[model samples]
Structure formats: structure tokens, C-alpha cells
Target: MRIIAIGDIHMAADAVTRIPEIGSADLVIINGDLTNFGGTDDAKRVLDTVMTANPSVLAQFGNLDKPEVNDYLEDLGINLHKQARLLRHRLCLIGIGGSNKTPFATPSEFSETELAAFIEHAYEQARASIDLTEPVEKIKIPTIFVSHTPPFGTAVDRLASGTHVGSSAVLSFIEERQPALCICGHIHEAAGTDHIGRTPICNPGMLSKGGWVEITVNDTTVQATLHDRI
Candidate 1:
């Protein structure tokens, strides 16, 4: 599967078409902040614009998006907020929307515990939906966690001030479960990749700024590449 991950859109709907492989990618995952506290109408506009380029899309609403936008995404049947889905036959996908409690108190901020629960529940959902009856090695399906916030203490979470403002709960989860990939965003300046144990973490920054992550998943490998602008 070829996947494209983008975040912090902030209403730059036209930018989706700017991606080099937007139309051809197997899947497009919008990490969050599709609008600036915008409602369903605004969400619809942005999502529709992306659909123009690629119809296959899964998304989560970030802190900057209005709380009700979650329901709007759910209605669209492309919501990945605190949810999981099977990716072809190669991977399991899970995600959590919103950021861990921020000082600005954004509309979709979540407590650390709540964020932890969200990912855990989503993982369980994914596991329950799949039949894991193969051999031990065959049962290990590669996983992707599309989170809105980068995990704590990673290169993708550092800001200009040098503080790691990501979620410790998320960090702990990654350390424990070690998903094959974690595509995160919200900290715009930290548009890069990092690692937790063997799990690769990526922050694609803001889509409006032309940041994204390209992922190619096959039976042998799941490769995520950082794109500063594409």
C-alpha cells in the first residue's frame, strides 16, 4: 500500500491537489486540523477538495477543528478519530484525533488519560475485527498509528523553545505496542521523523506549508519518508 499522510491543513483546501502523487496514492490520511475551528460546512469544503484529487481518504480532526467536526467526519464515514481500520491485507490502521491538553485550550484537546484510552480502544477494535489465526510470525500484521500529536521526547515534537510538548501517554503507548509506523502532526516546525524502539514516528507538519509523509507498505517492509515540501 502506498500512503500519504498530511496534517494541520487549517483550511488550505487547494493545497491537497498540489501533492505530487495525491491522485495516484493508494490511501491519503489527513492527520488533523482540517479547518481553523470551522464547522461541518467548512469541513465539507476541505474534504470535498481532497476527494477531487483522491477519493480514498481517512481523517481525524485536530485541536483547531471544532469538536462537532468529529461527528461530521463520522457522518462522512471516513473518520479515523479514535478508530482503526484494515489496510488491504498488509496493515492495521489506528488513530486518535485532537491534541493532549494544550495551554491554548483548543476545541479538541484531550487529557493524557483520555488520549491513551482512545488509542488502546482503537487497537482493540482493529485486533477484534481481524482473524489472527495464522502462525506466530504471520499473525504480526504491521500497524500504523495516525495520531494528531507527536509522541513526547521525540525529534518530531521539539519546538523552537526546545520543549517536548507531545503526549507522554502516547509515548508510553508506542513504547509498549511499538506499531510499525506513527504519523503525527500539530507541531508545525517539527516536520520530520523519529523513532521509539523500532517504531518510526513522523510529523508531517502543516499541509498548507507543503509538508507530508510518504509510506510504502509491503510484506517485508513499511517505509515512511519525510517530505518537507511535495
Candidate 2:
């Protein structure tokens, strides 16, 4: 499976849609920030544009987006927020939308406990989806944790001002569970890659800046290639 993941769009559909990989990839994962303090209508505009190129879109709303946007995305059957869904080739996507509370007071911000709960909930959902008859080791599905907030203390969560503003909850979960991959965004300038143990993490930055991650998965092996702006 070839997946093109973009983040922090902030309504800049053209910047990301123009990328040639969008039309050809098996899936397009919109990390977050589909709107700028806007509602579902704004998200619709952005999602509609991306779908025009490729309709296989899985999205999560960011702190900048309204909470109600979740329902809208769910209605469309393309929402990945707080969800664990199976994709082709036994690939499972575990998603957590929104971000931890910030001083700026974003619309969809949640507390640390809430974020942690969301992560566990999504992971359990994925675990439940697989057949339990096989041994746990034998049925290890390739999983990707897509969180809007990057994990704390990683390069992807640091600010230009040198402050680490990532989610400690996310950090803890990643440390313990160690999913196949952690794809994140929210800190736009901190567009880079990092790792916790063997799990690779990628923050694709803002789509307005043309940052994206190309992931190719073959069985349990997942390779993520980060693409920065042109």
C-alpha cells in the first residue's frame, strides 16, 4: 500500500492537491487543520478538492477545526478521528484527532487524559478487529497511529522557540505500545522525523508548505519517506 499523508493544511488545498502523488497513491491521509477556525463547510471545500484528485481520503480534524466537524466527516464515512479501521493489505489505521490544550485556546483542544484515552480506545478497536484465534504474535497487523499532536520530547514536537509542546500522553502511549509507525503534525515548523524505540515517527508539516509523507507497506515492513516543500 502506498499512502500519501499530508498535515496542517489550514485550508491550502491547492498546495497539497498539486502534488502528483495525490492522484496515484492508494490512500491520502489528511493529518489535520483542514480549516482555519472554520466549520464543516470550510472542511468540505478542502476535502472536496483533494477527493477530486483521489477519493480515497481519510481525515482527522485538528485543533483549528470545530468539534462538530467530526460528525460531518463521520457522516461521509471517511473520518478517521478516534477510529481504528482496516485498510487493504491488513493495514490498520489508529487515529486520534484534535490536540492537547494550548494557550491559544483552539476550538477542538482536549486534556491530556482525554488524549490518552483516545489513543487506547483506538488501539483496542484495532485489536478487536483482527481474528483472535491466531496467536497475538502471529496476527500482528501493521498499524499506524495518526495523531494530530506530535509526541512530547521528539524533534517533531519542538517549537521554533525551543519549547516542547507535544502531548505527554501520546509520548507515553508510543513508548509503551510501540506501534508500527506514528504519523503526526500540529507543530508546523517542526516538520521532521524521529523515533521512540523501533517505531518511526513523522511530522509532515503543513500542506500549505508542501510537506508530506509517502508510506509504502508490505506486510509488516513499513517505509516512510518524508517529502518537504519544493
Clashes of each: 0, 0
What RMSD value applies to candidate 2?
1.6
> How well is each residue in 56-101 modelled by candidate 1, as lDDT tens digits?
9999899999988999999889999988798776788888999998
- C-alpha local distance difference test of each model: 0.87, 0.88
Error of 1 at 52 (Å): 0.3
Structural similarity to truth (TM-score) of each candidate: 0.95, 0.95
The CA lDDT at 165 in model 2 is 98
What is the overall TM-score of model 1 with all chains considered together? 0.95
lDDT of 2 by residue, 1-230 (tens): 89999879888887866786678899999988899998999999999888998998999899999987888999999888888888863788989999998999999999999998888788777767764554222465777889999999999999999999999999998888787889999999899999999889999898878798999998788889998863
